[model samples]
Target chain A: MFKLIKQLTSLVAVIAVLFAFTTESMAAKKSKTLKNTQKKGFVRCGVSQGLPGFSNADAAGNWTGVDVDVCRAVAAAVLGDANKVKFTPLSAKERFTALTSGEIDILSRNTTWTLSRDADIGLTFVGVNFYDGQGFMVRKSSGITSTSQFKDGTSACTNIGTTTELNMRDFFNSKGISYEPVAFEKADEVVAAYDAGRCDTYTTDKSGLAAQRTKLSNPDDHIVLPETISKEPLGPVVRQGDSVWEDIVRWSLNVMIEAEEYGVNSANADAMKTSENPAIKRLVGAEGELGAAFGLDNEWSLRIIKQVGNYGESYKRNIADTGILPDRGPNELWTKGGILYVPPAR
Target chain B: MNFKLNKIIPQLVTLLVVVLIFGFFAFNAQINMDNRGIEFGFGFLTQESSFDVQFSLIDYDGSHSYARAYLVGLLNTLLVAFIGIIISTILGVIVGIARLSPNYLIERTAAVYVEFFRNVPLLLQIFFWYFAALRALPLPQDSEPILGFSYLTIKGLYTPSFVWENLNIFFYSIIAAIISIVVIKNYAKKLQENQGKQLPVFSISIGLLIILPLLTFLTGGVSLDFEIPVLKQLSTTGFIYEGGLSIPPELIALTLALSLYTATFIAECVRAGIQGISKGQKEAAASIGLTPNQILKLVIMPQALRIIIPPTTNQYLNLTKNSSLAAAIAYPDLVLVFAGTALMQTGRAIEIVSITMLTYLSISLSISLLMNWYNKKIAIKEK
Candidate 1:
């Protein structure tokens, strides 16, 4: 019997070793995402399954949104065509693994850049595209206009693994009010639960709240509370140990912002190339070695602007145009009374 | 000698190949982790989880360790499985017997039930219960109390919980009762075997179970108090039940879906077991002047159980595994709390997922081991 037990233990050890091997083999080879993506002629970008104005699809299966446009801009910069990108819709639970495991070259989901996620998760946050904060949405009929009115024992629903859950706890704990959280794995589940009145309030990023409110049966019945609890710098992410790939994704996002800062959008990008303003000239890639530094052509920023438009244009087209939330608020350019400031292309 | 040598050579080659494959994988994983600069360790288990579970059977909060969070998830999973198993077993037995009923309506009803629940996917059923049916229930302020103590509302089902004093003594009394009953049962069996005189063991055991537990409340310094749920208003419109046990709607939906789906398969197992009993055994017991009840109790049930147990145990294990689908509806089961939330929080995917899988594997193996032992114990001894 002891001998049989010993053999059984060895068998289990063998099986564990086999599983470890299989999973490792399943992972895409390390640090070759950039080369592989270029060779494949399309960028595999991960986005949320469906969060309107962030990363969502229409009935015809055409993907469009802010996150989708980021991927498009990256594709245009790297491959010279915005359409040379494939969007893999990922849930919050699988987004990081999907990126680290090489299933997707870039994760453009509306993911927050937390310190632990940056340092510990074998991933790097490229840059923030949308400056957001956690907030709450409650029913208008509840007679509660502000978050302070959410007395002790208030129930709120939010996604489980996002910063929203932790922020909710922090907001309530600091206020010394006890609350119950009805968390779900999916964003849609949280929304559905809140719509069904399982929770008195729905909490997520304010942008997420705006996008999700449009899905509710009676959108007008809900009101977003006027308190932003935690700062959420939502942005694109890439795997760690791949500085080349990280720089490409980061600069792709920055170039769009810099173009917007210089008032050089897609419609006027070619026209702006003639301007002698050195900043505009450099941003349009008319006279600078900025593109070569990132291993792209001199006209990389021009391709990004020409194909996917500037950051503001992408926001206005996908987000503001959709009327999910017309006011860009903090997502606007720095000179235009918002905090969107990108460093010089030089 | 030649045959044995040939066999040993092939076996040795296979073992070498397996070892080589494992070594290759371990080396690759090491290189992969090194490349990513991600440390591989189980040290995270002792760190503060800093994540709250929506529903847990134990006292848990954000301050507890991840190990504690895992325990909460495991306990919640076991709680759901335990309740599901008991309810499904009872329902399955009734439905199984009803399917064999002489009444056409009864048998048809049972058949329809089995077909309906068995055909629908469990995930969809959970969604239907949680998202649609439970959502349609009245809000807390509008809901009428059930039995003047509990409220079933869209938020959750609020019921009274008992506050017990000296609960350990009560538990000890119950254990004592069970021990004494076992002793008496053995003594009665010995008497029956020796003198052919039967004792009323069933009644005596039931009496001991009830009386001893009651005796704890009377003289063992045990007291119990009921804390009923009370409605409290948060805002003008929002009302909630306070000061009692609140069973979250997620658990209700998960348990309901799991049992309803599994009971169909269990019902089929039971039906097949009973039908496998031949008519000869029944007729023989009846010809020996035994009543119908006696024939069923003495001859058919024992035979039927031997056929019923193994497969039914498999169904129970499947139900436990299917409880992992609780992640879909956010029931905070082992999968949702540990594998889903904790893995997302820590990003230690390999370690967390391996732990979760091993936990389930151990559960399955232990249950199967117990069932095997029981099967062996009840196997008929050959002459």
Candidate 2:
């Protein structure tokens, strides 16, 4: 009986080990299939929660944003359904790992593409979604105007797992200044610290600075610095190995820029299906198999436009209409003296 | 032959099954890590960390290697554990004695303390102290000095950082006092055994301990000084304290929770140790012409320690392990600095996580080994 019992226990252990291995293998296989299906060819997009003017869910929980349009336009060119894409809202720390792990097809979470993150972490940055910089917000009574004027030994409030933290340290260090840092893991904590007078200044992205300022008890009392110390080129990121997935993500962003340039929006998209221009005709898939190379049909771009709208349409509704408008700045298209340029659809 | 075969075959089969299971996991882990391009290695320990820790017991910067960072984290963890153990021991003994007190109010008050702190989770207690409790403090500039030496501010508790001069001479004096105590204890034991004479060994040991350290200060050039924090303003509004050591609120909260939580268990152990001895033993000692103090010193303590040491050691071990929760409050403990941040940067999840888990396991195992030896030494000698 003892012998039989020992045999049974060992058998259970072996079965448990086999179960774990098979489950892991099955999970890997499923992910591979998901990747192939996305590339053959649908837009696998990731987005954020209601961060008004950047990315947010509507009353129905449908994502709309300057960042979201980048994904939708790619879907239009690839899958023929801009609504065919999947959006996943990610926390600050989860964003990078999600992209690297292939858990999300693409990350467009206002994530800054840094040199070390790009080169060392093995991720590909297709294009910039927003060009921002780090700034500090302080109470008006603090009498701190420029970041340079802020002396050493002041406790500055900041968030963890963001380039804004590194920028704050490097900027202060370069100026031969030393400050006691008070870091928190969330935006709410940083806001609370600043509001409670626990910190001399709260530093983050310029857009984040604006958002956090609104949450303060006296929004008018806080002033953000104008000297943008670091270049935070926020954009979408993808895994390193898959070229097919990378191309799909890159073109999705380009399609949005191209649509904005061509004046093709959700309202005019159906009319564009009968346009005279060969470029528009081909893009609308009224003519050729340009998308089939991406493992998608020719009507893919049209569907994307119909579902999510053009870049200009998305930007205006998501960011500009609310309060922050792209004033012919870096976000404007190349035709209007901006840097947003797209590769021609051959 | 058949009976022997039954035993041999089953043992062989069990061994084969255990080996097979291990082999399967080893095989899959190899393949899975290879497919993901993650190589398992401890080489990251020597690589530049490029991360800054907020609180450290030792000097550290991003320029330091990951190994140094681990040391910083390990040392900080030990520091908190040591402080928590000392505080809990004192609090636990007092509360445990009070719980058995004749006075109704004192007993009730001790019971209330034990019940209130014991029920709450250590993490919540830490958060309450750090976020809600510490946040209510005055700013550095407005902070009133405590005892004219320390400043209690929202940033942290800034106390006078000690500057020791000729510390080695002072340490030698402590060692000398300890050696004399051992000699005196042995002499007293011999006097009690061979002759019917008794010596005041405890008082002599106490006098030696104080007098030796004092002698070093007077003649051996041993000195100590306090670096008090002074408030300084850089700008019109911004102010900070400098020159003194600042203990971050995270450490304060973590230690506070660990001590208060562990004290309840330690109190139970203390009460059990005291209550364990029958009333008959006290009466018997009195009948044998022993004084009350002598009965406590020679009989009760030796007996109570036998009961107390085991549970108290367990509490110390629990406190050490629970210190890992310091990660939640960003206390730069072993879990936060080494496991969380270092693993993210290096992408060496398997290696780093295993090392950290093994470190904690070894600490626990070694303590258990010492406990076993101590238990064996104190066991009753009987035929």
Candidate 3:
């Protein structure tokens, strides 16, 4: 009886081990099955929740921002209507999980594309939409002039799934300063900590610091440091191994940048359809197979540029020239000496 | 034989059904994983993790393997769990005694505390502490020095870092005290049993504990020092404190919420424990000429602990498991560091998540196992 019971227990343990091994294989398999099911209709796009310039929903629940425009451009290319895309709002912690879990088709959130993220984390960054860098925001009364003056001290903030925390450490360490990081889980908490004098300085992507500074009680009392400490090439990311879907996302961004370079706004895109310029002609679907390469319609690029406007238009309307009025410094087209460049369509 | 067969046949059928279904799943999974480019193995655990953690109880970096990251996360989780359990136990006992106090105000105050914290969701409470309450703290530079050397800022509480020399000798001294206490307890018990005379075992134990540890400092060359935090300026007005060890805000919020929330349940267990002893037992002890302290130590506590321990152990287990909610606050606990960031990095979601769940399960199981053994040892014997 003792030997039988021992055998039974070992068998049960083996079964449990097998059960666990199967579950993971099941998750990977299920993801592939989902790819087939998600071939048509509206593509689900994961976006940021209420970041003013990048991705924010309106009072009417309409999504609008530079990131939002990227998703809509993809939707226009794939499903014909720019509005067909579903915008699933995600927090910084939830964004990557939602994408990898196949809860969303495209993640157009203002995510930074880093080496670890691109190579180590199993996600492919399509392209850069916003070039950002880490900066510090401090109250004017603090008399802090630059990041170098901060020294080894306290910082009030939270960061996404990357080396922002490690970067902060390195930045201070390089200067031989030791700091106590008062990191929180959300942007709102970071702001509150700063406002309530919990920490003397708030650090984040320069764009986020700018957006947060505007919400301060005395906005003028704060200064964004002139020093841009870290390179933050913010862009959209997708799950790796899906090249077909990757091309659609990649080209959707490319069309926007190309549109901006060709001066093709939503209003002028329709009239410029018959233009003699080869690049504009190709973009408007009058001269090239750019749309066909992505399994999209010939007028896919046209509809995107016409419906959502160009990259420059999207930026100005949402973040820059609009109420936020974020300065378009390096975000200008490559032809205009800025780094917002796209590869040639041909 | 026929009657036994009727019972045995159904059990056999049910077992067969379970096995078959499990087999089918296993077979299908083997095929599916093979179809994809993904390979199933634990080899990835030893490969370089190439990811950094913010707060770790153990040394770790990107250069470490996934196994090392797991260790870092596990240690942090255990550290938080141990700290929370200790704090909650002390608070619980006090509140539990206060509830039964003759003073109406103290009784009502303890009751109010129990109701306020126990009724709220743990996650929301963690958020409120981390997001709203802790956020109101002063910046490191602007922070007022606490006890002359420590700084409590919005970033986290900073205390003077303890630099200990010859720590092993100090530790050995404490171990020696513990061994002496056990030996004293046994001798006292034997003396009571054989001669019907009891030694003041508690006082003797306390004396040994203090003297042995003091001897370590005097003769063992054990020494300690503190590194205090100082304020420094960065960029125009940015002020920060440097030098001292900083406890990140997440750890603070987690401990505060976990302890406060679990204390209520523990208090209830304590109250139930003391209330379980019959009034007749207490009266009989007093009639027998036993003092109040003697009655408690000899009669009341023995019975009360029988009722208290099982439930208290369950609460401890619950607290350990719930510490996984550290993921929500980015505390880099086991689930957050391993199942979260590492899973994203390796794309081995299956392995990472299972390891996380199993880690929590084992902790819960081990505590339960210990509790079961204690319960068995203390169970009432019947003739």
Candidate 4:
């Protein structure tokens, strides 16, 4: 009788546990992250540790840059205030894990969108904000202008757990030049190692090279080679299984780009709400129900534009005026003979 | 019978509850992963890694599989641990003995070293060694070779590579010499026990070891040559030593920091072990007219080892685990390559992290088992 009692209780416990899990697994209709962010009254954003023109924080801990503008745009659209954002600075290795593990609602770091990261790693890349390419930086004293002067046994310094490692290998192998890769976990460490003359060249994204070059002891000593090794379309990322939150972030960035195309600055965003053109009016929340699809108010896009400004304004404030990259180059809009294009906000 | 049933029933209930909780969590993870469209599998191990490592012991390239990359990382980790344990043991024994020396300066220095290195965090020390100390080394262009054949620069220590001819024959000769020395030592031990004779076995073993390996070079088809490193210029100012064994500064810094930090604790363990022995035991050995060296070797050391082995084994294990800090300095150890880079690339966080944890557990257990065996061997025999 005692043995039978034990057996019966164990069987009952197992079935009850199964029921609990099965009930919880019936895929959520609404985004848990969105609900959590709303309850907390802030959007949890993950950005880079410190990239100058991407998502760098000032001495007062106020984050600014194009990537920061993405999360700020989201905060304006969702939370109704641009400053209602908590930024979690992440390393290259910890960025995706931070997003997928629910540590952050939106990872607006300058993370490259690759197939494996999007399709395999439980992450969804909404859209590209920065189109970058891997490039090499050599010391000006090395007297090497192009990558063709790179010889066998040349050591290269780069950050670990980044697409730069893979691209570096591809570049060196294609050129049949045997090279050494000294990969560190932090960007600052790579710069320090390269500045210490431990490596013959430093390799990362072209923009990164341009930004980090200023940090060297003598900024005039290094020169970036004229070689773009791989295509790196860096963008914001969100966790999988939350399409609604992903669409909200996606449209937030798209609205910024579209606003830039429509010549709507933050100063004129309110005036543009009464513009003559329908497309311009829709961007400022005057002509359409575009906000309804995202479960937001009609003023969401307008708030983003008026508070966070358009993409061009963000680029000028953070990247160009800061002297990281003076030219607009490929980051300029499609109508201005650049590749920054987005689907029209209809 | 009733009492046994009463005890067993509660224990069984507790065990069942624990098992059910564990099962629920495992099931929850599976379901959550399923909903997120993240596949859980180790099939990526066989896929092409498509990544390169800076310093590897084995022949590895980006063309190799991820498993091969994993092996390279494991080997580098083991290499650091092996070198650290050996160096820390030697340093610890000397410093332990020095701390008790009659010389005031030597004892004070030893005391200061143990307190300073042990109290500072190992990570800070690692950073100091790599970022501060190693960075101060000269660049390859301006480097001066220390031994006319080896260059120690910011990049690494490039030494002359050994080019051996018929290495197998040379190894066989050395093996033959070791076998004979062991056989002779056994005979000498029995002769001492049965016939009260003491042969000079140590001298004989040394003679055989030298003659056998030397004889291999004379006639057994063994020849050795050194491939000296030559400075090669990448650009006008960039230079590197090629055609030799280049040990990266990462390995040197990590090994130096691990051994130095771990040696301090090991030195304390040794000091405690030596001091724990009673003074009467040494006085009694002196009364028996035994020499001081014999008293130390045959009497004091045997007892002190029983105290030292266990704690020293702990320090060894700590050194092995702490070698994972090589990730910070980019030594490509098991953590940096397998957990840091591989996990980031594959995004199989659960699988990769679990495998890494299990690997560290296995390495630790194996070290523990080996130490336990040695402890048992040197333990005081009881009737």
Question: Cα lDDT for residue B191, model 1?
Answer: 100
**RMSD of each predicted structure:** 10.5, 9.2, 11.0, 7.4
lDDT of 1 by residue, B235-272 (tens): 87888999889999999999999999999999998899
Q: Which candidate would rank higher by lDDT, 1 or 4? A: 4
lDDT (10s digit) by residue, model 4, range B24-113? 988988987887888889999999998999999999998999899899999999999999999999999999989988999999999999
Per-residue lDDT for A10 in model 3?
100
Candidate 2, clashing residue pairs? A74-A252, A76-A300, A76-A301, A76-A304, A77-A301, A80-A300
TM-score of each: 0.93, 0.85, 0.84, 0.95
Residue-wise lDDT of candidate 3 within A198-284, one digit each (tens)? 566788888888887877778898888899878888898887777767777888899889988888889998889889899899999
**lDDT, candidate 2, residue B346?**
65
Best candidate, DockQ-wise?
4
Residue A245 deviation, candidate 1, in Å?
A: 2.1
Misplaced by over 4 Å in model 1 are A1-31, B187-199, B218-221
Candidate 3 lDDT, tens digit per residue, B240-324? 5667687877899999999999999999999999888899999999999999999988898888888998999989998998898
List ranges where model 3 is wrong by over 4 Å.
Answer: A1-40, A114-122, A153-156, A166-184, A194-201, A215-218, A240-242, A286-296, A322-325, A344-346, B1-52, B61-63, B139-151, B161-169, B215-246, B328-330
Candidate 2 matches the true fold with a TM-score of 0.85
- Measured with C-alpha atoms, the lDDT of residue B17 in candidate 2 is 100
**i-RMS, each model, one decimal:** 1.1, 2.8, 4.1, 0.9
Q: Tell how far residue A75 is off in model 1, in angstroms.
A: 0.8
**Which sections of candidate 2 miss by over 4 Å?**
A1-91, A99-102, A119-122, A320-329, B1-23, B272-314, B379-383
Please tell me which model should have the higher DockQ, number 1 or number 2.
1
In what order do the candidates fall by DockQ, top score first?
4, 1, 2, 3
> Which candidate tops lDDT?
4
